[model samples]
Target chain A: MAAIMAKPSLKTLKCTQCGGAIELRGGHNVRSIVCQYCGSCLDSKDQFKLIHKFLNQKRPFMPLKIGASGKLKGILFTVIGVLQYEEREAGEFFRWLEYLLFSPTHGYVWLCFEDGHWVMMHEVKDLPETQVEIVSPRKTRFKARDKTFKVFENAQAHISYVEGELTWQAKQNEKILYLDAVCPPYMYSIEMRGSEQEFFWGEYISVKDINAGFRIESFEPATVFSCQPFVVSPLFEALSKGALIASVITLVMYFLISSSGTPVMQHHFGNQLFADGETSKEFKVDKPGSLYGITVHTPNLKNAWSFFDVRVVDRDETNKLFTMPTTLSFYDGYEDGEYWSEGDTEVVSYFRIPEAGEFKLAVDGEGGTGEEPAEGFSLSGVNVSIREGVRLGHYTLTWFVLCLLAAAPYFVKYMLFEQSRWHDDEEDDD
Target chain B: MAVMLTCPSCGNQITQITRSPQVLVCPACNTTSFLQNGRLEDVGKSAILTDIPSIFQINRTYRHKDWKFSPVGRVRYDYGDGWWDEWYVRGENGKESWVSVDEGEIAIEVLVQEGLNVPPFEKLSVGGVLMINRQRMTIIEKNRCTMIGAQGELPFKVIPNETYDYVDLLGPKRSSFTIEYQAGGVECYKGVWVDPFEIAEA
Candidate 1:
């Protein structure tokens, strides 16, 4: 339902049906003018004859009134007419407002408001060239004014209401098939009625800009529109780039700072040392204070257990002892006619060398074969190997993990924005 | 040489600005007269046009970019939906052109000479295609406009309330053409759309 109001006449004329003063702003070009006060459609060309009258029509929400002037694209335009169209697709009803704007030199332009989004449109005489893909036949492309647009929507829209002065005689429920194509921030609409086809090109305008142009209050957008472009702030862009660069630099520096560890000590001892209950060895740590790895292997110890206490002393007369307690166990027997082994035969551990000097390593051990080692149990042989300056992986991993954590939120939001833009297409895929 | 004639309706002396024009409307009494057999003939009275907001005026020199012309005559046509004005102007080089003003749209057109094949008006339809002067054009609008009034001196005779059919064709790059069907066969005019903001008083 549409109720219109017009004021301030260029040529003051009275409506024949309702005797209401109708103002004509489009000069002689206006074919029909509706009585704003009485809802009577009057012929503007033939002495304001009564064509028809709208009865009990509800007035829809309109932001701009007829005869209201606003500046658009550097030209002053007046709202002379408005048409409300409703599109019913798949049982869903969609309504939009179209305001016909008039400028003395620029002719006419339409501003369409839908779902709190505004689009400024102009009827284009030049039609776009269309191409259909051989693969994926549902995808249609239109090329116009050097921009390619993909088909976004296809539906039929009907004129629900008409108001004010119009160039042509408009009636209720006039159906027209429309095809919409989008190229981001711009869209092309092809409307067909019988044999007459009209092309309209439109550009998406921000609510802030539209409000400022009309000097009206702000209109909040209900949701993201199809043609609404994703805008990234400069700070966000800089931070994203900086994080990526920092991660790469940290990885490269970690590799440059690490190396393979050098061998420092190797020795083999017989079970006689364990039988004596103690052993000691002096080794030179030639490198500066760094991490060192020590490995102990007992190849010949079978079905036996051993407990040992090891210490590293500075050998500087301070006799500072570093205690390391270790347990080695191995057992094998036939279970269900299959052989199985338990416990480990080798163990490795890491320690930091305090300084580059001589260090004395001492070990004392007890061994057993079955339950009590005091009864009778002995180890065969043992091997000890140590290496200096080994690389640690956690340093590089920590920096990489931190960078990923910092960027996850922004990346997820961007992905969601793109997914929302193609939400209709994704639903079709499902 | 300029020939001065007296208006048959008002008996006022009127001078012919250009020798090619056979019709001239009296500025004083709004009476239309035609030159025939070296004598002025009364052709009834022309309607006094209402003053609408317009950018160009009769007898005023207007400059559009590099081209300068002064409107010597005007004809108003009522084409159902709206009325458009055709200003007959004489260029600075003494040539003539037609400037059409429809609402805010303005175009500078010149008469295309005969010898080019033109299609009949009856077969023309809106959005139809046409080949005129070796250029592919599309028929944008077809209108049967009635000449409501005329003022000043025109190059051709203009009859009051004379209805004629014309088709407007648009070519590539804003090139426009109009084919008018009259009692004497058909006439074509070719031109380009002009920016109204660039037009200034010379």
Candidate 2:
């Protein structure tokens, strides 16, 4: 309905049908005005010409009457009209109320009341015609908004009652068809009339906000609308946002701290040749630790893989046992017109060593073949290099898993919100 | 614009195509008369039109979904509450259709030709659905409406105060079908709903 901002006129006209006093608090622009006493639809433009004498006053529940003033967005607006609409689906009737509010400066806007939730809306004149029904391929776009909206409710609604001044001739029980899409706190609606279509942009308002805006003592509806913005639980939104930021900060910290790590000790066994099950001289460790990385480099191995199973025993009186298994494989061969090579000749294993001390190194080789002794490809004969330090990969992997665990809840929450909005158009796959 | 006729009472002449049994309220003197057999028979009636704000008016040019239309006539239906206006229009491709506007909704209706087998009116229920012409359409409402007024060229005569019962059905892609039951015959109309804002911008 098109309404304009006009200065308030003190002129009050008697309803031609009922002689009831009528005031133009909505402004001179309102075309149809209903007599509050007799419920006569009058043509406000043409001397309050009687349009229809409405009977069957099964009035829908409305807490406020026409001409009630409310302040919206700090602007004072007077209620000009009220309309009750009901949509029937699946053997049930869903009803909602709409109040037409007029600010002498802001013209007219609608305050929709349904399921105890309120939405304020204004007429929208243009939208891509192609967006008739949820834009099929693109589910979330409404007009020019960056967020995509899901279908809130799509049903045919009918006007059940009208009161006071309205932009159009107020109907008693006229049918209206509309499709509502929500990006919550915002809703985009397309209404269909005979051959004319209209658009409305709606914003979800809290009951508290409504009461404050209207300066009402309280407005507490018994039931909540299924499409209420907070139905998804705002707690989930806060949790997801907070967790996402925390994960990013933790990731940065992990990268910085992990990169600055240095090896605590290093050992070279290049000069000493060792055989299988051979134990080397004890390397004294100045510090005792929980976990250490045992790195071994067996140089120049070919055509096979070599694995060493190691046992770590503390040299102290109480020799607690800790063991780690490492693999070093280097394979090169030519067959079937293609040359293939695989497996690194060096490997590292990180494990707990009870406590650091005089740690002895043992070399046990298995499954090494097809190479000369000089090439160091045979088992039981290769150099070993050991580095005992904080394992960056181990701690980094632990933090990465922790990050994933933290993100899982947020991901599920996003899907749940989408599920609630998509409840109408889609059946849950689950 | 079609055939020109003189208002029997006021002698005002205007181009119009009157359906066989409709009353014409003289655009000049507001004299209402029944047009029967190429002659105006005085019925002595007039209507005080509630000013309806609409961009799609009589003889106005507009485009809807690739088809250009020129509104020729209108028939307003009174369903006890308010008026529902169905504008008789012709497409650029020479197809005659009805465009209805009530509240802010805009939908076009094209008369379904032969070959559709629809059940009797009594068999249709508000919540019941049926497959018509291979499209699944759900019945929304069934109403009995009377002719309130009309203007200009029309395909069917605007019988003064004639009542008809119709059922409204909705289908996929915003397509809706109307099953109108009349005394002599039944007329079936189907069309897709459109957004007025989409076309207003176009």
Candidate 3:
């Protein structure tokens, strides 16, 4: 689809209308030349005959003048002409520019710039695909990359300025209604005049790349395009893949470490009571292990929660080294107005011991309506179960959390893709 | 090359000579002769045109697509605000084709014959597709520019400034298409984008 262009040659032709010095530098193949002085369009083959008189407007971005050379896809090209276009809707005026590029070998291409973003496009001989579904009253559906893109912009674009040689009869003030279907950096455009339509396809070019092609060192695009894939895009992709891989790795590690958990104890201390400040039970550890598990169960409280403050401590260590107290609450609430509840009436806690020793499983003495738990709410039949092993449930829960975090990058990617669809287009539900 | 013919207006033998000059000036009577139907028909008085800078010179051959084209003649059109060039190129096979360079694009063009039916500009639209020679193509741009004048040699007749309407179509591969509405009803043309580098001296 791409090839080298013809070598450029310069021949001087004076403008017939203005006698202004005119230069035709694209190649002898150039058909038309515009005068810089008197603004005359003339045939490049012979003496300049007045095709039309034109008043040149200032080139929009003057640095990109005619005859400027650049490389696209590593192929050299010369800017043979520049045309500026403007349009208006809803009392707001929008403008852009298209630079005609000539590749003596490849023939011709166009560089379009709007709000500082540039797109290199050419007439596509092959149409991508079309859809039968009508997107809007005035627009149709186009297919690209297995996705359907709706016509987002359809407006009349007018020529604003022109300079250098053109292959077609390009005149300022000529306007054509063009429809655009955009999928981020790539856009499919159609220009309709009368009964004929033309198709052109293009991709967004970063300012950095454009500058490098044109060899412009001091340059920055007017506005950074939102659809312009960020340099960190690849980084996000790498991280997303890494996150998924890490999630799986973490899950496997979770299962492996959790497999080492051996149930050291599962004794349920049942119907325990504390008449004093705190009633405690002593469990002697024959061997110490990596982790501890505590499960407390209470009698169903109809629709109430019973709270118990429990602690595990090594009696051998006077400093109460393992005396970490934790609150265990049990609830068995019935479905009620304004809210519904369904949960187990049991809770769990864990403690780790450094060495084998005698440890005390202690429960606080009841104070709030302490006797018989004041009727409806009670902790009298409360049972406490303890186990010593690696905490498998902790690893499983942690693995799930890590997986959720890992999925975040993909969501971000999706949102960014959606945002790019609307970046240069006016909002439309269609 | 100058073609000798009798001026119908001045009734004088005149010579229309120039390198592919489409509109020839009869030096004997100042009669403007246009090449039409294998004859130089006098249209009006001739206007002396100034020479302007062009990339290609006469007698120089350049390559475009599979054809080697040496620009022989050219026409310029004015669309009110600006003007562009359309060149007549003679190929190695002795086939004549038009290549238009406008706003920096080069397209190989040919005259569409008469009697071809074309929808009105109001009815057709951009992003719309049309069937040509049984192949589907997309319409990208519609143009309306008036022919102002021409120079050098040409295959068809030309008026100094005749306005016409047309549309640009694109094929699937890399072909350029154009349909023009002129006095001859409709004309269809197929063209392809050409690069200078790909084109070489023939």
Candidate 4:
């Protein structure tokens, strides 16, 4: 048997919709062919049928260079074929390419050299549409406690670098046109260059633009950067201690009022009565009338008499010697003997005490039959004593004192060491 | 060997006929005839006209091995000295195919074989003469029928009488040609156009 080697199929078809060509198969199979240029597809068999025929004719080749220009988002751009260049070239071309690929939408044109490298850029106009306005550079000085430093004018707007050690003479053309880098730490410096000074500084300068145009006028250190220790004064400390003492006294008064109990006073008095027989009954005091008075006094006296008064009556009534009724009389004064008279009803009242206190009444009667003179009656004298009110305890006072003591140190330190308006002025000086 | 023939009705002269035992029909009276012993004899009225002429010819001899034209496609080949040869062929499927030739003979033969089918004639090159009738087309080279076209418009057709000023054949000389239906008249003629790549059997 002979082996039959099959040849690869060479007959191909072209897409009707998008002008792209493809290879065909047995019995004109209906397969989709997509145009590479426009991405249109021929899905149906009728659509894939070719209207024009092309013979597989062989021809020669030609070399040509072509370019295309188009607009994207209103920005005109030109795309060139591949470019070729040497490796050593300083990649300005590559930078231009990167700018084109990543830059914001702007009109750009690209060039392709024969070496297959590419360069793309926006066309450079005579002047930039936007420009920077620079004010004239000036010089200034800063002081921190004892340390002095010079800050060039316009330094706040930009960064400043020192051309040399702190010097009296100012450098020329202090303005900084561009900032390249910034160096840190205590000596804070900036690296900058200007178009006018480009030749003087060359490519870049370590320190060139600081303290350039204006006079230093005066040099001083900045207090914020100072590291000096602070000390407190004695007068302020004493004033703070006095404030704490006043606070302690006020706290003690508050505690005393809150802790003590209410105040009260007591007094007692007694009296006895007797009846006479025969013509007249006479009463006499066994103990002399000492005039015992119980008086209760406070800041307001009207409330003291509510508990002071007492009412008394005789219990025994005996023989006809009581034919004469006993009369009671009251005396207002001891010297003048002004008396209160009872008419038919035989009760007498003499005086009232302003405060609650015990008082005694003396009584005497005329005897009608004159027997043995009436037996004498007597009343006992009252007793009274003054007592102190209950007091609040001492621990409350001690706690108040302790609270004041606890706050004293912080108060003293704040008064003496904290910075004030006057201290800010002092810090501003070198 | 070749045969010379005279038209039976018009007595017009014809020569260099092939020994392939083929028939010819005269353009004057439409006489059906065959070549015998270096002369032409008329067959009876039952004989009918059969061969036609081709206006365009393939100038190369060999055909490409891989060349195939389905429909509308174009191919190009590079010749030496920066010249290009191109071919476009229209197919029955209403598709076109193009092939290009370059400096090498093997590449040219491959392109030719892919583009054209086998000619039912013989030994035809550039500068050959063609005879046409209602039925068949024939190619005469050196006054002999070196190639023949089958009757009835062959499976594929060419635009007739369309001449090309091939740079290789004439060395920068220009030419004009036209294509027409045999019964009607010439359709269109193009003057001084570059020669097209040759077609051959695959």
In order of lDDT, best first, we have: 1, 2, 3, 4
Clashing pairs in 1: none
For residues A1-430, could you state the per-residue lDDT of candidate 1 as single tens digits?
A: 0111123337677778777776667655668887767878788777778788765556689988888888776667889988889987678999999998887656777889888888888776546755522121223776876788877777778887788888777765778887777787888888887656777778888888778888888678868776776667878867876777777777787788765578777777666657664444667787767788777788876788887776777665357558777778898999999999999888877788767888866666777786666544556668777788887666886896777667666678777986887787889889
lDDT for A288 in candidate 3 is: 67
lDDT of 4 at A311: 23
| Backbone collisions counted per model | 0, 17, 71, 85
Could you tell me which 10 consecutive residues in candidate 3 chain A have the lowest summed lDDT? A1-10
Q: Which is the winner by TM-score between candidate 1 and candidate 2?
A: 1
**What is candidate 2's lDDT per residue for A259-292, written digit by digit as tens?**
3224554444432233435565565555466446
Runs with alpha carbons beyond 4 Å of true place in candidate 2: A1-8, A133-142, A145-147, A217-242, A249-390, A393-421, A424-430, B1-202
- TM-score of chain B for predicted candidate 2: 0.85
What is every candidate's C-alpha DockQ against the true complex, given to 2 decimals? 0.13, 0.01, 0.07, 0.01
Tens digits of per-residue lDDT for model 4 on A148-222? Answer: 323221221221111110111112213334211101111212223443221000111011111111111122223
Better of 2 and 3 by lDDT: 2
Candidate 3 — what's its lDDT?
Answer: 0.64
User: Which stretch of 10 consecutive residues in model 4 chain A shows the poorest summed lDDT?
Assistant: A199-208
TM-score of chain B of 4: 0.25
C-alpha lDDT of residue A168 in model 3: 62
Fnat of all models, as shown: 0.24, 0.00, 0.14, 0.00
Per-residue CA lDDT of model 1 for B1-202, tens digit only, reads 7788888987888777665777888877888888887677888888777655467766778899889998888888988776788989999998999999886678789999876677778888988998876889989889899998787788788988889999998887668899889888788899987656557889
